[model samples]
Target: MLYFIAPFIGWFVSGIIKFIINYIRFGEEAKKRIGNGGFPSTHTTIMTTTTLLIGLAEGFLSPIFGLAVAVTYIIIIDATGLRMHVGKHAYILNRLERTNKGETTEALRESMGHTKVEILGGLILGTILAFTLNIIFKV
Candidate 1:
């Protein structure tokens, strides 16, 4: 049960935190726009949570735990590297698509990736949440 729900918990909590942060930093306009690229990447949070939970439930030396760690590493790397570049490209394209009159004909989404700090934030949150849950439920 814990394994099944840990990722969801991590995602929901990370998303709530991201939403609150966005609201505080960008105001109501941020609320009007719903997209990714925020502090504490939910993708990282869920993967980290899954990895940690697997390490806890199955021994850290177990093959499944090793697989979980590998998957988590891949996810984190993808979020910080490739996806980040994609977001940057989207930003540039969006700017390029703007007309002389300051009206954008078509705007590309720029929230496709997570920054390093965002990934770190997710890592920390996931670690804490996983340990807490493990302690409480012994899973």
Candidate 2:
């Protein structure tokens, strides 16, 4: 039970901390209705945390390690590429709407995702958190 709970708890705590830090650093700018990528990505946090825990539990040299790395890469790519592209499109749409005398002006939800730097930061933070926890708990 404890083993199962560790990753979840670590993810939750790390996510909250990241959210708070993002809010503080970015102010209201960080608040978004829909999207990802703020400071430390919750997605990265949970995925990395889970991956680390699994690797520790199973074995880092096992096939699962490759799977986890692949999954993490895919997620980071989606967050920075696809999601960021959507956000840019939304911004353009918003601008076009304003040019049309506000008739088509619909506030497309901004912050569809994180910048590349933000995603990189998330990756680093998640990796550190996972490593630290793994070492501390000896899991």
Candidate 3:
């Protein structure tokens, strides 16, 4: 139950935070955050929460806990590395398209990765939520 609940809670909480932050900062453009890329990385939050919950429930030395940690590490690396670079490419493409094509086409998405600060925010949120949920659920 903790496994199922942890990921859901992580996604919901991180998404709400991201939405609110983007709404405040980007006005109507905040809708874009619903999909990906924001102040709090939803992927990181979900993976971190899930991994920590597993560690708490299964013991940190357990095989499943180790697997969870590996999965979480992969997610973090993808968010900060590959996806970040993809987002940069998207930005450059959007710029080129705008310069050459004018407003005829939609812009490529430029927010597809988490910055260091955003990842840190997710880590903090995930950690807090994991401990809180663990205490409440006694798992």
Candidate 4:
């Protein structure tokens, strides 16, 4: 229960703070923050937070912690690698489609993965939440 709550707290905090900051700095450009792939990656936030909470609860050297790390590594890699790759392709295709005028009815999704700064934001948020939850719940 603690692990579940901890990760969610991290996700919420990261999303809210990033949204507000982006809104302030970028104005309407910050609209991207409302969707996927923006200043902070919510997927990374949730995954990292869960991993850290697991590690804190299970002991850093424990098998569970190792498993958590491995799983998180794969997830983060996918978010930054394959997911970003796909998103880039989508952006390209969408731009190309725009040239076709009425040929395409739907727009492709451009936001799918996090930039380095976005990933870092998630990591920081997750770490803070993990520590806070650990202290509060003594997990």
Candidate 5:
């Protein structure tokens, strides 16, 4: 029960912190909202936090650890690579649409994923957070 709950706690806390940071840095009037891509990646935060906790609870060198690492790697790669590319493509498409129609359409922005630096930052932050919580709770 506690094991199941830890990840949620970590994710919630990380998300709140991220949101606050975004609000502070970008200001309340910024076009972007909280959880926008800039700093620590929430995707990385939640996934890495959960996996690290699982790994630590199970065993650092166990199969679970390997699986967790693989999952984390894939997520981070997607967030930084494929997602970013798709965002850029969307921007170009949206611009083309606007130019052709001579009016701006209500289109969603697809550039919501993190950069490599942001992913790395999230990885480091998540790892530290998970490790710290594990130690503090002696879980």
Candidate 6:
């Protein structure tokens, strides 16, 4: 296997970088919000990073690359599609709860998925990191 380090590193560093940027744009609360489903979905960063690394390490036409592509597709789909519903639902429920009763200490987690823009950001970050690593190490 290739070092497989790029994906993990990219996953984390990209998120942190975006989080910092968000903080700059929106203040401290942005730091907290950036940790989850925001622009540059962390999940997509990791998955696309892995997929690209696999493609680079193995021949793009190889079965390993194919498998990685398949898995990555599913993961990105989940991040952008299925989980978005959950986030929206959480927001709705949270609003409904607040409407019926006063504010509650507990609130649903709503950052479960990525929007198209967020996923696109992830794709870009992953592409940059994975290719940069691949070029540097030539693995």
Model 3 agreement with the true structure over 1-139: per-residue lDDT tens digits: 7788889999999999999998999899788657778888999899888888888888999999999889888998999999989999999988888779455577778888889999999998999899999999999
Expressed as tens digits, the lDDT of each residue in 1-139 for candidate 5 is 6567766766677677676777787777344655446567877877788788888889988898899889888988888888788778878888788779577677657656787778877788788878887898787
Error of 2 at 120 (Å): 2.4
Best by lDDT: 3
Cα displacement (angstroms), candidate 6, residue 38, comes to 0.8
Order of all candidates by lDDT, from best down to worst?
A: 3, 1, 6, 4, 5, 2
Q: 1-139 in candidate 1: lDDT tens per residue?
A: 8889999999999888988988898898667445567888899899888889889989999999999999999998888888889999988887777735665575777888888888899999999999999998988
> In candidate 4, which residue ranges exceed 4 Å CA deviation?
28-32
Q: After superposition, how far is residue 88 of candidate 3 from its true place, in Å?
A: 0.8
**Model 2 lDDT vs. the true structure?**
0.72
What lDDT score belongs to each candidate, Candidate 1 first? 0.86, 0.72, 0.88, 0.80, 0.76, 0.81
- Name model 3 segments beyond 4 Å from true: 101-103
Give TM per candidate: 0.91, 0.76, 0.94, 0.87, 0.82, 0.89
For model 2, state the Cα shift of residue 94 in Å. 1.1
Per-residue CA lDDT of candidate 2, range 1-139, in tens?
5457655765676667766776777778645532455666767766777777778778888898779878988988888888889889988888888888635644887577777666666667667777777788887
Worst 10 residues of 2 by lDDT: 29-38
Compare candidates 4 and 5 on lDDT and give the better one.
4
Using alpha carbons, what is the TM-score of model 5?
0.82
Who is ahead in TM-score, 3 or 6?
A: 3
Worst 10 residues of 6 by lDDT: 1-10
Model 6 Cα lDDT, one tens digit per residue, 61-113? 99988988888789888988889999999999988888875657677889888
- Pairs that collide in candidate 2 are none
Q: Residues 58-85, candidate 4: write the lDDT tens digits.
A: 8899998898888878877888898899
Runs off by more than 4 Å, candidate 6: none
**After TM-score superposition, what is the CA distance of residue 109 in candidate 3 from its true location, in Å?**
0.6
**What is the Cα-based TM-score of model 2?**
0.76
